[model samples]
Target chain A: MFFNMQLTYEIAGGDFGKAGYASSEIKKVLKKLNLDLRIIKKIAVALYEAEVNIVAHAYRGSLTVEIDTVKISVKAQDEGPGIADIDQAMTEGFSTASAQVREMGFGAGMGLPNIKKNADELNISSEVGKGTELEIITYLK
Target chain B: MEAQTFHHALTILTDVCIGCTHCMQVCPTEALRVKNGKAELFDNRCVDCGECMRVCPVNAIIVEQDDFSEIFKYKYRVALVPSVFIGQFPRDIPTRGIYSALLEQGFTHVYEAEHSAELLRESINEYITEYEDKWPVISTFCPAVVRLIQVRFPSLLDHMMQLKPPLDLAAMSYKKHLIDKGHNSDDIGIFYVTPCAAKIAAVKSPVGDESSPINGVINLNFLFNKTYRTLKNNDREQCPIPEKEQLKDFEMTWTLTSGESTHVNRRSLAIDGIHNVIEFLEKLENGEVTNFKFLELRACDESCAGGILTVENRFLTRDRLHNRAKQYLKDVSEGKRLHNKSIDQYKPYLKQHINIKSIPARSMLKLDEDMGEAMKKMERVRNLMCFLPAIDCGACGAPSCQSLAEDIVQKRAAISGCVFIQQSMQMKNKLSNDHALRIMEKTWGENRFDKDCTKKGAKDES
Candidate 1:
């Protein structure tokens, strides 16, 4: 109603074959929105990393993206084992992925770090054994 | 960024087009739209790949060419022929006969278009070695692929190798040779016998380079028919055709599929056909493809052998070229020095001027120049999509329903173009029956639904 656009996608867990589908779709829309290619690529990479994190480490997840003229905000909520130490999880090369997931190359522990690097803002909250909610925001300007 | 004024060689004969929508259905870029009983082309979106020409039933799509007599104006008329054209002759027609036939057709000299392909290969290897960060370098060999990247995948333009194609190098080398031999530049006219519409477009409007060295272009089908008839009708044995140096084994098959990839001294992939190239480029843009140092992206199925202007079957021409290459290889192994003296002598000069200045991406994907306006328009497009059927039926004259929606938002078309919507409005008494018929006729043609027995495949056809 305020001239803001929003998109939501239901991402299935453990479906590594389809991890990048949502990110690809989002990239297409952003391209149509005439965003700079550099910004679109950064958003796509960060969204893909977040989506793959859900597939490799969670039961299931949903991603919601809010778009305005000034900025874009993404929130990913997953139902799975939560991170104990968010700082440690954010550290590069600090992956808690299973041996199988690592072998498949899905769990590069740079997920949270990369999101923070590409996005202008990042926030994380989780319960011990419940789930995790990751929020990322990037300014359009 | 490059300017939006693209010179396309493919021209649709509007009077001859029957609004069949065949070309619209198969276009890879959705650049075609049928209106007023003829298919219209969006100049910026068309890459001149000639898929429309391939599918047109009534030969309405045609590639423009220089007049045949245009070569006669100059004292030195050089016929720059592609290897695919050479492979079109029958078995009885010898290679020398092909050259003699060209000589008979007012050409003072003949040269293979891929003569400098070897030199081009060396330059590409050096560039790939120097610029490892720009891995998976897409070849600018296919002019259609170069234009495709300019329009659809602007971001990947950095990965394009900034080098002129073999045809340009060949033309440059020959021109330099003629000048060195004391021929006046004004008197020399280099005409290329093009295998496809894309090359003709490239010759007319070169990208990444200042201007094409070729002065004119002759359609492959037109030239091939003339030469074939000449070789078949007359006794060419007495034609003093010298035993000139043959094309190297590599040069002979350079126009075939996978030919360029195999020559590249890198981990490369050769993808042919416009659709296949588009799919692979999409994966490349998405970061799915890796470890490739080179990409030979061709717009035709069997490479230049499948050009729209070619006369022979693509497979047959490919086999003939390979067989010709095999003979050349056999001659090489038997101590024959089939060397091109001009190219070898002009190697340093060609190498010195090999690199293209710049190729800017003119992306056709963006809806508007401003991000805010594009976003607003995109929102409107999404809203319109909810009301339109996604069946992609071409009855509305646009290639797909999405195409119609975008056109509507752009104000180039209206929502009433959809037949289904017109029917719904008519049932609701919102539109008169005559108004609905008028809308359909406006899109399809005037009197399009009439019973004409003269049309193709009609029951009471003439």
Candidate 2:
């Protein structure tokens, strides 16, 4: 019989040091299920980059990592300054992180692209001066 | 699917945990949860990556490693050594001496993984040249980096270079060699000389589509002290590792972040240090810096030299890596092309079944046969998160404040799991009531609606 589990991690805005916690737990769950390593990795990357973006760019947010026998899905929502340009942001290498983020070794702008790369399907929506929402899914058949 | 059977290999003692949340912040899997008064561990989600054990300040976390007694169980043991071992010892320590030392450790045979590195380097170069149009290709060398991508950056899976890691390649080669020598395959066991807990976990429970070629992991730290003492009396240079000319240069290259770039002259990017690499990979994903053809990312600051389990200083280890790289340069010849046919033959062996679908069992854990229980659990989780010091210290058994809350809500953990929450609870019941209603109201809004509707509500809250 197929079973499902949903886990959540809160991404604190401006906390670069605490990034990727949710993604890490999601990875652990995927691994325990004996899913393919490559596929698990793809889910991990997408979830992590999105989580980091929430902390670096958003006011605050939470990442819900949902896993099941059929697929792995991550939904991240943040209450902060949202993306100004979804198209521009999706382009590889585009980022708005500040120097402090760079000092912490983030802000290189691979967050979105990496997310796109790992998930079989990705949908993101954001409003400037508002918050952002991301939905990512990776199949596990 | 039961969470109980999933062992908690990495752990923290409540009194010493300190609740810093560093483990939560750095954990790639989001496995930790901090609740009421202490940290609680979740079994079904832990990968045993050991990042928690490495980052804990009070030494509260401990990682599980196999004992030497495990060696006796294998009939024929093979050692899979990482290329970074070249930098750990004195310059005078020859490869033969190292091989002989491994023999003394109960390994029936020793194969230098450097050959796999050479094979991987050639394959990557050929692939990059053939697919030059592919923008910003990422390296598949580091297991942790790969896992980070899988769990945190799945969208970029296509960007990851399609190559087996050096250890996997080496294990495949070792198996082929064993078959050629007419050894019983079932009797032979491959053991990786792991440099980090992540590698140990990788060998035990790999993330991607396929199982690891190696049978088990032996931490270098667990063996280094004993092995070094054994080397004191053995012939320092008596064993042989074939000829330098026969060795593949790719293995030599796995020592540094620029290792891939050294082999292929492409517009590649390389970054060491976990946080820095994450940023660089993020930028690469964001299209902020799009000129590179390949990216070699490492989790450790000095590449493998800074692996969590290594004994040597990162700087010194890096210096030694440089010295070894230079020595290997003499062995490369333009005539030295990797046998493409041989590489293809090994493909079926390395390729394993992978499922890109979301993990079903995990998602099932989220559902409550009882909606009321689930809602109540969500309330408890939200309350726990609100009280979290927000330090993400990981002192709580869970990785973070939110993770702790989720665990509590899911009924995997309890309210008193976070020490800070208990401290605050003791200080004043008023603190608990401060935003209890508000937090619950927010949870109802965010959790009860779809993103479109939730977005509208979330905007107002923000």
List candidate 1 segments past 4 Å from native: A1-3, A14-19, A55-59, A80-94, A97-117, A125-132, B1-7, B240-243
DockQ of all candidate complexes:
0.51, 0.05
lDDT of 2 at B275: 71
Docking class of 1: medium
* Interface RMSD in angstroms for candidate 1: 1.9
Find the candidate with the highest DockQ and give its number: 1
How would you class the docking of model 2?
Answer: incorrect
Across all models, the iRMS values in order are 1.9, 10.1
The TM-score leader among the candidates is 1
**Runs in model 2 lying further than 4 Å from the true structure:** A1-141, B1-30, B34-40, B43-49, B57-76, B129-134, B234-250, B330-462
